[model samples]
Every structure is written in C-alpha cells, then in structure tokens.
Target chain A: MANGELKLLGTWCSQYVIRIRMMFELKGLSYDYIEENFANKSELLLKHNPVHKKVPVLIHRDRAICESLVILQYIDENWSGTGPPVLPANPYDRAMARFWAVYIDDKLPRQLIDTLKAATEEAKAEKIADIHAVLELLEGAFNKCSAGKVFFGGESVGYLDVTLGSYLAWIKAEERIVGAKLLDETKVPLLAEWEKSFLAADCAKKFLPSVERVEEYVRELLVTKWKVTSA
Target chain B: MANGELKLLGTWCSQYVIRIRMMFELKGLSYDYIEENFANKSELLLKHNPVHKKVPVLIHRDRAICESLVILQYIDENWSGTGPPVLPANPYDRAMARFWAVYIDDKLPRQLIDTLKAATEEAKAEKIADIHAVLELLEGAFNKCSAGKVFFGGESVGYLDVTLGSYLAWIKAEERIVGAKLLDETKVPLLAEWEKSFLAADCAKKFLPSVERVEEYVRELLVTKWKVTSA
Candidate 1:
C-alpha cells in the first residue's frame, strides 16, 4: 500500500463495519478491505483500537481511526471534496443528524440484542414492544428530519441513513428468528418505505450483507456466546 | 430574544451541562442559562429534548440541540470564527480528539458511580482499580494528544480538554466520598498536572461547580436514586 492509502479493518456480519463500507461506496473511494475475525482478532485491530478492540478501524496513511461513527466523521472531513458530504452543510442540521445517529446507536442495537436474548415468551414480547417504541420515536425523527424529502440527507443518503440502514439486515434477521415483524409498515409507514428505498440504493446493495448471512451469524451468537438455544 | 439567539437548558451540577457552559465561555458567546430541577424537570427541557429529556440542550434560534457532545460540535461549527476552535483544524487530529472524548465519557462517570454504589469493600476496590486503569489509559492519551503541550488541544483548550475537563468536579467529589485519590500524582501524573492546569483555566473556574457541591449532589444521588448509603 502506498502512503495516504485508505484501508478498512472490518468483519462481514458487523453492521458497524457495513456502515463504513457503505460510506466508502457512497464516496466512490477505493480502498483495501481487510476482514477481521472476532474469535481471533488480529494484532493490527488490537494495536489500532486498544480500548474497545472492536472492528471497523479505518487506517488512512498508516494512522488508525477506531469506532464506526468516529470513522464515518473522519472519512467525511478527510474526503469532503470527493463525496456527497456525509454530514449536513448547515450547522443546525448537522447537529440534528448527529443527535439522531447517536440515538439510533444507543437505542436500536441494544434493544434488538435484548429481543434475541430474551428467554421467555413474555420477555421477548416486552423487548419487542420496547423496539417498537424506539422505532416509533425514530419514525418521528424521520418525518422531522426528512421534511417531506426522500432521505435524511434530503434526496441523498447521508450519515443517519448509513447509521440506521446498517442495521436493516440485523433487524430482518431478528424478525425472522423471533417470528415477528420489527418494522411494521402500518405502524411506521415512513420508516418501512425508507427501508425499501435505502436497500435499493446502489451503495447499500454493494455493501449490505444478506439477511440470511446475518441470521446464521446471530443464531450462532445466541447458541455459542449467549448460551441460548435457538427456537 | 432575537433570531439565532442561544438559550441553554441545564442544571448546574450536571457535568454534561458544564461542558456546554465551558464551550460557550471558550467561544465568548453569551446565552440565557435556564436552571432545571431534576426532581420535576422543566417542561421547556421536556419540549426541547423530547427523546432524552436531558439537559445541556442548546436552543439556538429556538431549535433545540440536545446532548452535550452534539451541542459542542454545533457550537464549534456555528461559531467557526469565534474565540477558539473547539475541535482541531486537522481531520486526523479532530478524529483522535473525538475518539478520546468518547472513551472518557464511556468509562469515567459510570465507573465513578459504580464505585459509589459498590456494596462491598471488594466491589469498591475493584471499581477503583477499573477507574485507575481508565486514568492510566487517559494519561497515555494526554501524552499522545498534547505532545509536550499543556492541554489536549496542544497550545490551547480544545474539544478533548473541555470533554474530560467537565468531569473534574465529579472526579474530585468521587475522591472525597470514597476516600480514594482518583487522580493520583504518582500513577497518572500527567492527568494530575493536566487537571490542575485545566481547573486553573478561565473557562473551568467560571463553569465548574465547587467540589463540595458535587460531593453533596453525589451523596444525595446515592441516597435517593441508587438507594446506596454513602459512607
């Protein structure tokens, strides 16, 4: 690799990793994608992200940037001229984008994981309800943010889109495993519609892993890591 | 208030709120600070931040930007030509600053709270050890980021300084309550020195609450919220 070359350390099943991959595609930036195995994390990943030791570390010019959201912001700032800007141009809009992106990361993933980890039928139902509540809040956010525009970035997929859209596969996989519809069209029509459109996007198609693949990974996670047998 | 006027919905004791206050002072921006009661949170705060309903909500031109970190970035972007830049001009430096800021927020406060809420001496000792480990890492970060300079922002206080600096009062309070020197001079000498310099800075003196106030608040929080009896 040449000096100033971009390289991403990630895994296939990670939504956080997928977010960066999607961003790279969106920017039309070419880079080497180094896949990491979670079971046996590479020294590069460990050295780069000593704190979390998590994947989706973006190595640019031999300097590593860890955390998915942080990586996304770095890419946007570093390659501002090369891409359709990841964050909004206006300061207030940018704040809102950051706010919602953080919200999605804080709420959705944990709730989705809880829904999977739920032992009893009652617990699963309760967790599913919590997920719906979060989705409803996000639905309101979508309406407020989009402002009758197609995407959160208004006619372009930006930061929030990648943040939330990265989880679509997992959401679908969870839905399949739990035998429930997490993103019901009737409840959150806009998000349901947005999902279709986001999935249809060129970058998303190139980067997003298959729902089946995520489903398999999640099932294994439940069995091996979580110590719960699949239904 | 005129259009684009700033109003901060916050409580004095909140370190999250202190961060924004410090940022405002650093930027030399004036704003109306509305004190909120946590026991019965103000409707204004609830209205502004419907999702979190938590403060340090920066209401600019009547548009609310919730979350301290988000608000800090917004202030930086909106007032790019202000007194001092909150974030670094260089992209990679900005990313590093952000990474450390996030790490500080993720580790410190929670560990401090756990230390207070620890039911046993062993638990408290473990939590204290965890905090020391985090501080040790932050000491390394201070060296890496400062690079022979006084502050994390190098020549002046920037994003990372304000972020980790906001928790100074709480750290002091935790030290007092637990009878443990959290920022030990011997262990994390760099952070200890940095703390003194940061506290002596103009913005910190103006914004940071007294250590006694924070100690009282934390003790009360222990009794009421966590149901833990402070020693």
Candidate 2:
C-alpha cells in the first residue's frame, strides 16, 4: 500500500533496531534493512537523523523517523488497516501500552547496562537490587494487565511484547557477562514464561540476535572500553 | 461527559505540572489540583507513582498515569472530543510531534540544568556552547514545522507547544541564575517570538510559574545543595 521506498538504517546487534524489524514482520510489511557500521556511520544515517545521529532510523519515502518507540507508533498508525494495531484501540489502553513501553525502553535498558558496567562489587550489588526492583514492578504490571493472555497485547504479541522482547537476547548476554541472574524464574515467573513464548514467536525467532553474538559484543565492550576482564 | 473525579498531584514549580494545568484549562475541564510538598510528599503521591516517586501524576477514574508526556497524551486522548487534539490527526505529523516532544522533555531540560550546575567557568562555558547547539537545532525545527503558524500544532498551540511551553518560565529563571543570555532574539528569533505569544496566552499566563519564584528556587538550590553562590 505504501507508495514509496521504505528503508531502515540500523546495526545488527541493537535492540532498538530489532524492535522495528520485529514490528515490520508482525505487520507483514516489506522494507530494506541497511546495516550501519558504528565505527564509520553512513552519510544517509547522519543525513536522516542529524540530531541524535544514531541507529534504528526508519526512512519511508525519504521521510525519516528516529527513536524506536516513535517508529513503532508510526508503523502502526500508518499501517493501521493491514496489521494488528500495535497500540490498543481504547484510549486508556493505548496510554497504558505507551506507559509500559516507556518503562521498558527508558528504564530497563540503562539499568541492565549499568548492572554490567558496575565499577565495584558494592556498586554491582546496588545496581542488581535496582534491577530487581524494576523487574518486580514490571512483573506486577504484566501480571495485572496480562491475565491469561498470551502476550501483553492479548492473544498475540503486542507492543509491550515487541519492546521487552527486543531486549531478551541482551538480557541473556548480560547473564553470562555480568554473572548475575536478573530474570530468575521464581522471582518473575510470568515474565520468564512470556520471554520463552516471545522468543519462540515467529517474528522474534527471525529478528532476535543470537545469544552468543550478544555475549561476544558485551565481552568485547567490557575488555576494550571498560578495561575489565570477564570473570 | 466523564464520570470519574479527576485529581492532579503536582509540585508548585514543576514545568510538567504546569503543562497539564494548561491543557486542563484549554480543554475547559474542571479538576482539583493538589500541590505536593517535595520535602514531605503525601502518601497519595507516593502510592500513585511508586516507581518514579515524582510529581505531575494524574488521577482519572482512579487510574494514575505518570510521566509528563504520558500524562499529556492521556489527557489528549481521553478528552479528544472537547479540546483541540494535542497530536495531529495524520500519522506522520503525530510522529513528528512525539519526536520533538521527546527532544524537549529528555534532551533540553537536563542540559539546561547541567549548564547551571557546572562548577568551573570553563565547564559552564562548554555547557553553554552545547545548549546553544541544541537551541540552533530546535530553532530550525520550530521554524520549519511552524512556518506561517503561531504554534507547532499549526493554527493553535499543540503538543510541541505544551511540551516546550512548560519550560518557558524555567528558562527565564535560568537566565537570571546563570547570568548568561541563552535564548537571545538574534540567535533564536522564532522561539523568542513564540515564547512571548505562549506566555501571553490565557492558559499559559494563568498556569505558568512566575520568573521571580523560579529564580528564588534556583537560588535556594545553589546555596543549600549545590554550594555555589550566584555570580
């Protein structure tokens, strides 16, 4: 239905990029994915997203949309007729979906990274506590909002599923690199089950980066930039 | 039209709270505003926003929504029939509105705070330069998006207006505390003009905090917490 070329600029291992890709697959839309080199960014990436100059920029008919969650909303809204709507039809539910997505995107990712890059044992412990607190909150949110539902979207993988699902591989990678178990099944049983189902979903199976690749990237990052030896 | 009681919990000086108040006024919605004491927050505020423990939490029909942008979207969507839609109807335009709002909410506010808190003159100068670069980008965005229009929403004040307008008073206060003119007319004429029109609007004039009060708060913050006497 789209009249013009739809191009996506992203890195292979970025969770944000994975989000857009998964959304496209779920929506059954076709688009070209251009893998951007972080060391040497392309002119197209820079030209499209001059402000952030970051990845996961969606170019539709040459109109670029940056930020993953924003791109997801754009994709859903533009393709409302064809795809299962990423946001709920009800206003309140849409707000709730957005609220959870923001929590997953803004809060969880940074905390996970910080847990990995903690400078000292004390800091790591504190960061782990913070992560647990966040997880508990999300666990409650998911359990309360998603009762007997296959996904946060109900019946199928919704916006929240795509959002948190994008980070599944990274979370696993952090488990190996950080040597801390964040998503303990006992603590967050619902999320644990949801993660399993999410990964097994057709879209996730295709788009999610391999756990080994994510682990390697994390290990390399720690050694080269943070000057830490993987234990 | 609505059945439930609407209550807003906010601090006196927060720009975010002011955004909601302005929206309420523009929409002609009657709601109770409960001023939150930052030093000794009420149990209600804590309960509603457990994760953030922050202000500007809106209670509609006993459902609490936190985060300024999320609250704004909630308000807009719930009251779509009454007020001018905060987000444009077009999907692309909605994405644009959200993109700019994120930039204003996430990027600009923290940078401005950092510019104020910089200890050394050299660091302050660097922060000021960074702020200028951000302003130049915003200037271009506002000018391009708001061509021949009074606000970013086109005819009347829209989402971007509310997002940026909330910070208008705080920006004025920063000018006094930092003692370096940031939003000079020569540098950002469009924004300067928009600022005047925004503050003069009935909604803004009534809801926005006074420059004197914001300056006083900054003065107290520097003296008691930051340990810096104003230059």
Candidate 3:
C-alpha cells in the first residue's frame, strides 16, 4: 500500500499461504505472488525468512514478516482506513477473536499433523479422539460467535473466519486420507454450516484449491513420504 | 483499570505467570494473585481454561483469557490508555514485534526443551547448536531494534521485552542445570544487557524469582521429575 514493492512467497498446498492470499484479496491489494516449491525451497524464501525458512512470508517495503497470523494482523493494520477491518474494534472482542484465531493456527493444526502420523489402529483412534475434542471446542466457539450471523465477523468474513476457513479444503482432504468422517453434520452442525459459507465466500473461492486437488496432494504425501496407505 | 474486578491465576515458578504479573505491575493495576498448586490443579483453572488447563489465566469481570501472550495482549488492549503501550504505534513494527514474541514463546522454548532431554554429549551439542542459531538471530533483532535505546519499545519496557524478558530467570536456571553457558555474553551482548535491564526493572524485580530460588526449583525438577542430574 505504501512505497516499496509487495510480494508473497507461498505455495498452493499450504493453508497458511491461503490465509495471506485471502487477506490480500479481501483488501483488494495487488502483489507479485511467488509460488515456492515445497520440496526444494527458493533461496529468496529462505533469505527473507532465514529463521523458519518457510513459505507464506509477506514482503512489503523491503521488510519481511512471517507467521500467517502475524501477517494477517500486519495486513489489517497497514490497511486500517481502507477496507473492512479483519479484527474487531472492541478491545475484548478483538481479544476473543485473536484467541480463537490462535487456536486455529497453533493448536488445531498440530493435532491434525499427529493424526496423519498415527501408525496403528489404536494410535489412530487416540489421535482421532484428540482431534474431535479440539474440533468440538471450536464448534462451540463458532456457534457462540456466529450466532444469527453469516460469519465469525458477523455479517462479513473476518479474522476468526479466515483463520479457520483456510483449513476447510485441507480438512476435507484429511477426511479422505484418513478414511474417516471427522466433521459430522449432526454433531457439529454450526461448524459444518460455517465451513460451507466460508468456502462459498468470494475471497476464499478465489484462492482456495479444489478439495479434489488437496486430497490428491495429501494422498501423494501420505503414500510416498509418510509411507501410509490411503485408507 | 476499568469498572470490573481483575484477578490473575498463577504460580510462583512459571515464567508465563511472571509475564502477567509484570504487566499488572507495570500498569499499576490491583488484582488478586491466586497461586495454583502445580501437583493438584484447581477446579477454577480447569473450568476457565478447559482446553489447556494451564496457568497464567487472566480473569476480568468473570471472563477468562488463557494463553500468556493472549492474556498480555488483552491487558494492553483493555488498559490501553492507562499505561505506556506494549505494542508499537506503527503497523509494520507491531508485526515485527508479534513475530519475535511468537518466536520466543513458541519456537525457542521447545528447542531448549529438546536440549534438556539430550541423553548424550553429541546430542546435547547438536541441540545446543540449534538453540544458539536461534539466539544469534534474536540477538541480531534485539540489536537492530534497541540501537542506543533502553528497551525494545525504545524508551520503555514493552511487549517484546516482556515476551523475551519473562524467560530471563529460566535461562539462568537452565544454564545452571545444563552446566553450559546458554547466553554467551560475548555473542548476544545486547540481549545480555537487555536481560540485566529487564531483571532490574521495577516490575520484573517485584515478580522475578531470585536466581538461587529458580536454580533450586530447576534442580528439584530435574532430579525428581526428569531424572536429569545437575552438572
């Protein structure tokens, strides 16, 4: 939005990268999108983010910022006067939004990773239980926040929505990969509905990959890298 | 600061709890400090933070906020006008601050944990090297931000300072416990000096455990819990 060039170093498969993409689309900002090869990372990506050396790095005005949530906050703050604010104005509500966003980014993803690595039936069962517990908690939070509203932002797609929405495609892919129905409509009806709304949103639809593509990538990942047979 | 009551659920040995304690002290707010027995967690903690069930929970007017960094941000936002701001006024700088704070809270501590669990000298060395690489990066950030300034907040001890400063005592105890110098003053001179200033600050001095006490606690933890011998 300012002087220097804006660029996003990202990959198509990353939910984190999708978070930034959605933010950029929502703000209607133009930037050069550099797709990083996940197997062999680009030197530019590593140079900008030497600490983590990962993708989804936002480079604006020669300064690099990593961590998807941090970048989201940056985008919102940088464009404060322009578009709809991703974070709420109220201090406590902002805090609650941040709390759930962190839950989505930091907490839930790790459990999903562990579930992917489950070796035996018992291990898979335990991981599934853990994942369900977290999802149930999130379902409750989603229902509470989005009650009588289209999204977590209430009448618009906001911070908490994007945070969890980025994972919708990956969640579907995981269901296929794990051969399990994770988000049953009867149990988590609200979240299931929110998932539908989130994916159907204009911002998400622009960047989110098809569920079929994500499933294919996940299948390849599990079969070749993790040595897990597709369930 | 506002109309309702402020209460902190914490424990003496926790660096996270120390963060909120220091924040409250810096803000000049009065709150009931509830020390939780680590062995037997109270029902209040479980009820408030049903997900994590951990310490450093901030309760204001009966609404609970868990996660130390989340609680810190909540305090800053809720008491925005009363104290010197914890986050910077500029958007990009705020993003940088959040990035480093997350690196300290999420990334560095886990590496340190792995170092502690290293069984052999070679493994410990590898972990130590990994830890140092991260510290060196942090050292570079601290020097860039604090160039001729008192704190990361330039004139005041703010969010990033507290985020990294909370671990000063733990770093010291870990050095003693591991029988290796973690923060080599020659390498991380700025961080070393910042650690001194942070510990000597009025807020930190009030809540920070003495080096002896922390060392004793770490020693007990190693011997009884982890079976790590004090070098």
Candidate 4:
C-alpha cells in the first residue's frame, strides 16, 4: 500500500471531520487527509467500512474506524502513549464524557436531521426545541463543574471538549438556518463561552475548516435537503 | 447511609436496570437496589444526578453515575477490572462494538418509545414497522456475525450485548404494552436468536426482571402516558 500513517477519510466542511482533525492537531500528531465526495464514495472507503458505508472514516494502518465519536476515542486510545489523553484520567469523569456524548447523540441527531427536513414553522420549532432541551441538560452539567472553566471537568479540556467541538460549527449554523440562536451569551453563557474557548484554541483554529466552508456546506445541505423534501 | 457499597436507583422493570444488573452479575458485585419513583423522583436521585435526573443511576460510595450506558462502562472499568474488557481489545473491533451501540441508540429509541406509547391499531402498526426497520439492521449485522457464531462480534456476549441488554426487557414489555410481537423469530430470525443467546446467558438471566414484572410496568407506563396524550 501507500505510506502507512494516520489518514482521515471524511468530507470537507463536515463537523465530524473537523472533530478528527482537531483531535490530531491537539495531540500534535501528523496525518494525511483524504476528502471523499460522499455522492461518489470511493471503493476504499466502501470496502474499509462495509457496515455503515458512511463518511468520516478514519483509516489507521489497515484498520478503518467509522463513526465520529468512535473515531475520536480510537484516536485517543491509539495515541495515548503520547501527549494529553482525550479522555480524563479519572474513570467517573471519563464516563461522564461518554455520557454526554451519548446524550447529544441520542437526543439531538433526529432533531438535527429533521431540522433540515422541517418546512413549517411549527415543525422547525419542534426541532429547535428538541436541540434546546438536550443543550439545556449539557448546560446544567457544565454549570455544576464550576464557573469559568476551560473544560467540562473543571480546568482542562478533555473528552467532553473534543466531543462537543464537532458540533459547535453546526450550532453556529443553526442560528442562521432556524433564525434563532440557541447558544447566545445571555441565555447559555457558560456553553457560549465553552464554544469560544474551543474554537479559540490553537489546535482547533488551525485544523477546523474555514467559516466560509462551513457556511457553504450547511447552506448546500439545508437547501438540498429541502428540495428533496418539497419534491 | 447504611451500607457503603453500591446502590442502584431504577424502576422495577427498567431495561437500564437490567443492563447494570447484567454487568454486576457478570462481575459478581453486590449492591443495594433503590427503585426510584420516576414520576415523583426522590430528592437523592435528583441531587445525585442534577443534569438528566434519569435512571438507572448507580451510586457508588455515594457518588452518582447517571445514564445507563455510562454506568455500564464505569462498572466494567472499575469492578470488572480484571476480566476481558467489555469493549473489544482491537481498535477496529471496538469501533464495531460501539457502532452497533450507537446505531441501536440512534435509530431505535424513539420508535421503541412510540411503540410503548401506541394507542390504537393505526398507531401500533406504524410504530411496529418503525421497530422492524431497526430489527432488520440488527438482523443483517447479526446474520453476518452469526454465519460463524453468536453476538455481533461472534462468540462473546460483550459490550454491545450489554449495551443492548437493556432493550431485551423493554422489547418484551413492548409486546405486552402495544399488543404486538416485534422480536419474533419469523420476521427477524437473527435478532430473535441473538435475544435467545442473551437471555440464556447467566449474566443476562440474573439481571432480567421477571417477564411478568416488566409486562406490568409497561402496562402502567402506557396507561399513564396514554391518559396524557388523549387528554
């Protein structure tokens, strides 16, 4: 095969893609990027990830890992020999990190998908409400971890930050998509601050796709999804 | 206050409760069972888990661990420390395990919840069809693994097994609550066999509430929820 190092398989402008990128940059690990046009998925991606057949596939050596959260965990586990572990040292805090990951995953995904599908005002509100409810839970959890903390577990950015980092772009996009902001400074100050901290960090700033790209991708997705729904 | 060991805060026939029980039994850990009245949740559960206030809450040495999957991971990491990790050792295999966990969590929860909340025949069939789609995905995944043996990974009742162990009781209750049989051998043969293998395992058998008890609980939940929807 080709040069055997860390290669991330994902589309440009995807939040999930941004996540894996930010993790590598944060870990200071060098990697190769293979952006896929999901419309015409590559044979390598298809064969490597036969199950999900989805993008944001991370190929390390010969092993191909799918799922963004799974990929992040895999990155941390494989590279744990060096640098700050993405997961916390304490088991409970690690579990809480995973717990939030699962919560955002379970609760928001349907709402997020449907938000794009939503046409009517009521439908959009329902979708927004679903996202708000889960965000509220996240906010309350962060609130308990003490104020003015850079990370979720108080002081340092760990698994929670990495997990939440992927979604910040989408949260930013939602304000434009739905015409309402969920993470305003006054409303969810702590969470809003976490977002700023996450993006402001050097690693995230370096690897995360440009805002122009995120806006372009979200705009295209929303418009394309609406076209399919309307027809 | 009395026994400084383990405490489980859950409903009588919770799927989440059964999962934790399976892990505890697998590791032979002993604990106290404090069934929460979720409707009027206790102050202890509320205080311990201010974020979600959800079950099954595991209180270990008075520290609250909320969310069933998170609690399962914690138990495996802590108490079941000296065994084959519930997660796969290989990175790809671990991704596969987490893949199914995330899939079931994402695609199935809402439909399964609606299946429990179904009122009439029309609602029931639609929900059952939704449930079937998930079962089909599981069926295909399991069939691939079952070509050799049982479980999604073929041989062991591991993390994905426990991650899904929660659903065994919930689905059995769905059959009772909605007057439907969603996990039948005829429709989803692979999943049906998976269910049998899971149920027969000593760990699963120990944690599972009596089928009669789960039936009763589902009926009660449906009645309560049904009243609100109709009103």
The runs of at least 3 residues in candidate 2 whose Cα sits more than 4 Å from the true structure, single-residue gaps closed, are: A1-4, A119-122, B1-4
What are the per-residue Cα lDDT tens digits for candidate 1 across B1-231? 363487998999888999999999999988888899888998889898888889888888878999889899999999999888889899998999988888888888789888999999899999999999999999998998999999999989889999999999998988999998988999999988899899999999999999999889888889989999746
Native contact recovery (fnat) for each candidate is: 0.97, 0.79, 0.76, 0.74
Model 4: residue A172 alpha-carbon error in angstroms? 4.2
TM-score of each: 0.97, 0.96, 0.95, 0.79
Question: Residue A70 in model 4: shift from native, Å?
Answer: 1.4
Q: In candidate 3, list every pair of residues with a backbone clash.
A: none
Across A1-231, the per-residue lDDT of candidate 3 in tens digits comes to: 554499999999898999889988888888889999977999889889988899899999778989899999999999887788888887777888888888877677787778888988889889888878778888888776776787888888999988888888888888878888777677778888888888888989898899899988877877788787734
List each candidate's DockQ score.
Answer: 0.94, 0.80, 0.79, 0.57
Residues A1-231 of candidate 4 have per-residue lDDT tens digits of: 257567888876676777788788767787788889878999989987776787788887867778888888887887788767877767777787787877776666577767767778788788877777778778877785535577674665666776677767676776766677766666677888888887888767776666556666767766675563431
RMSD from true fold, candidate 3 = 2.0
Off by over 4 Å in 3: A1-4, B1-4
Ranking by TM-score: 1, 2, 3, 4
User: In model 2, what lDDT does residue A31 have?
Assistant: 89
lDDT of 3 by residue, B72-103 (tens): 88888888887788888888888888888888
Q: Rank the candidates by DockQ, best first.
A: 1, 2, 3, 4
Q: List the residue pairs that clash in candidate 2.
A: none
Highest TM-score: which candidate? 1
**Clashes within 3 Å, all models in order:** 0, 0, 0, 0
Instruction: Give lDDT per model, in order.
Output: 0.90, 0.86, 0.84, 0.74
